[model samples]
Target: MFWFFCAALVIIVGLAILTPVWRTRGDNGAETAAGFDLQVYRDQLREVERDLTRGVISAEEAERLRREIGRKVLEADRRAGEESPAARRNSAGWIGAVLALALLLGGAVWLYEREGVPGMPDLPLAERIAAAEAAYDSRPSQTEAEAAAPVPDRGEIDADYAALIEELRAAVAKTPDDPQGLALLSMHETRLGNLEAAITAQRHLIEVKGPDATAYDHLMLVSQLIEAAGGLITPEAEDELARALQLEPQSAQGRYMLGLLQAQNGRPDRAFPIWRDLLEEGPADAPWIAPIRAAIPDLAWLAGQPDYTPPKTAMPALPGPDADAVAAAEGMSEEEREQMISGMVQQLESRLATEGGSPEEWARLISALVVQGRADHAGEIWGEAQTRFAAQPEALEVVRKAATEAGLAE
Candidate 1:
């Protein structure tokens, strides 16, 4: 379906570009050809005659100019008579036009084949969710030995967190099987880097969630297992990953972890397609996209294919000075740079005070102050932006994010 759209687009562009060439097949550059210069010379002679009639030029001067123009016109007529072979010129034009059209269409297809997934199938959101189910059904099921395998050790932890862990344990013990409590425990353990505990909590969460449990739930369990084993994808974890796909094949974390597991296990061929499809359908600005994009080139090479160039992502920029400004500052002496930076910010502030600016400009001012490590100044700008853009949520968010980055948020 994607290929069809691309082909149709190419056809439309090709027709639009080539249509004029096809229509003007008889244009042999004749209007500007040497043969047509005679008309130009005659026109010049008429202009001189008009000048004489208007009494702009004396009769003697006009006659001399007319004689010279007439000579050039006659010479032009002779060359045009020699050059006139309409059929030959028309044939040449036709040949050139045909070649141009062929190159245009052929080049498009050739480039797409070389640098693009020319005929790659499109996997819509609905289709990918269904595909996950099919993929899970096709994979080998886990063995009893794998299911019975013990959870990996989580190793040492800090005293403060360990004390909190005891409290979490007590709560879970009292409830026995509360899904919400277990879910919180799982996430908290993951945050504390206690993968073993996270895995245990997630399993209990799944038991309580039951059929209500989603593919994301199973996938998260697989994630905890892998992290606990120092990134080693155990058979039990793989089984959980399969269960995830069985529910939602397009689950971002599930597909990413599965592909990562395959790559780790030295099966880049399997990993490449999964990663490729994920990138195709994943949000350009999603947090997961950056790592996936960074890994694809290596994956392609491991698969013995040409290096892949993933599409650009929409990752947010750090809320501080832009690279160009930072680099320019780096080139200046410390004091000079400080003075210039201070002046630039001061100018922005003065303008905002004297002539109120937009929310975006306010956001920029706050970000600049943050980069300068002036939290107080950023906070001031944040307050002003809030008061100014209170009714506009989107505009307010821009300034609000800048303030938060500047450490001014309440």
Candidate 2:
């Protein structure tokens, strides 16, 4: 509206300047011609008087010349007076100008009303995230709904990996402050069902990531807690979840997990709305939607809201991490970026040697070396890994795969 008013004011002031000029165009021209003719007559009259004094012409001749010039000046004055501003004013131009201004202003107002948002206030990103977390926290706890929630089986872990696990544990203890070691330790510890150890490792991971840690990092920590509790939300996990949601209130995964937290706490009233809203608003093929759609009706029952009609959302799997990374790297040139990635790979290799790391770190090193086209180095790592995890074939497979990618498997 401010912009509209500004534009209108500019046009009106322009029209005001131009309208009088257009109307008086003919009258101004006539007055200018009259002034020029009067100046010519006055100059000739002066010459007539000078000639008479010098005796170049008689006084009688000079008088006749003066009278003739004076008559011509008077005639010019009469004509200028006859051409009044009213007579010379352009009525047609005045009409056209008024019509043009009206059209411009009217069209602008019409288009603005049709396409522009009238009174919507802008939402800053930080405020938006805070609001979302607050909304989630305000909802009821799903205590009554906890019993029927799905729990995935924690199948038996291979006993052969026990020795390798011990080695990694000792290596981590020696390098307690290393971020890479902690993340790697956390992943494998979770796989081995070492809940407390994994939780500790995850805390170290969060600490190492520090201020740069994103919502996804905090959310992952919460996930590790849920796993340790066999699909329950321990009080310890709530703090991590709060941090995640505070970072990104609109995070699809975070919201879904919040619903899970509510369900585990037996707050069906809260869980039902969270899941239902997420299902309706999220992408049609988001990975979390399928499970959410399935659970909505049962969650509704627990909420004592029987009118919940199940949405017929489809079952396509969501795109994975590779697609997401590719999307993020859209404007970067792969050829120029290879050198930077190679530098990082060298640094990782150096760190692993000096600080020591988990099997995951070794696997990452092999992969980075292969990506850098260092097949010889990758092969050496794979050989050492074979000796280190001889009993754990699964662990060796990670390094072996990277060796194959580097063309050293033969």
The top-ranked prediction according to TM-score is: 1
- Best of the candidates, lDDT: 1
Q: Over the stretch 82-133, how does candidate 2's per-residue lDDT look in tens digits?
A: 7546344555566667677678778866886899776655656556556656
Instruction: Give me the overall lDDT of model 2.
Output: 0.67
Q: Which residue runs of candidate 1 sit more than 4 Å off their true CA positions?
A: 1-164, 318-410
Estimate the TM-score of every prediction. 0.40, 0.39
Q: Assess each prediction's global lDDT (C-alpha) against the native.
A: 0.70, 0.67
Give the Cα RMSD of candidate 2: 20.6
Estimate, for each residue in 1-410, the C-alpha lDDT of model 1 and write its tens digit: 67678778878887876677656654655434764587678789889989999999999999899889888887887777666666456657678877887898898778878998855677665675466556544543233323554543323444665688689878988996998889878876775555567778899999999999988788768766665554456678888889999999767767877787676655677889988888888665333455567678888886767757777755554334577988888889989988887888888788876655555567788888888887655654665454334223445566778776666663
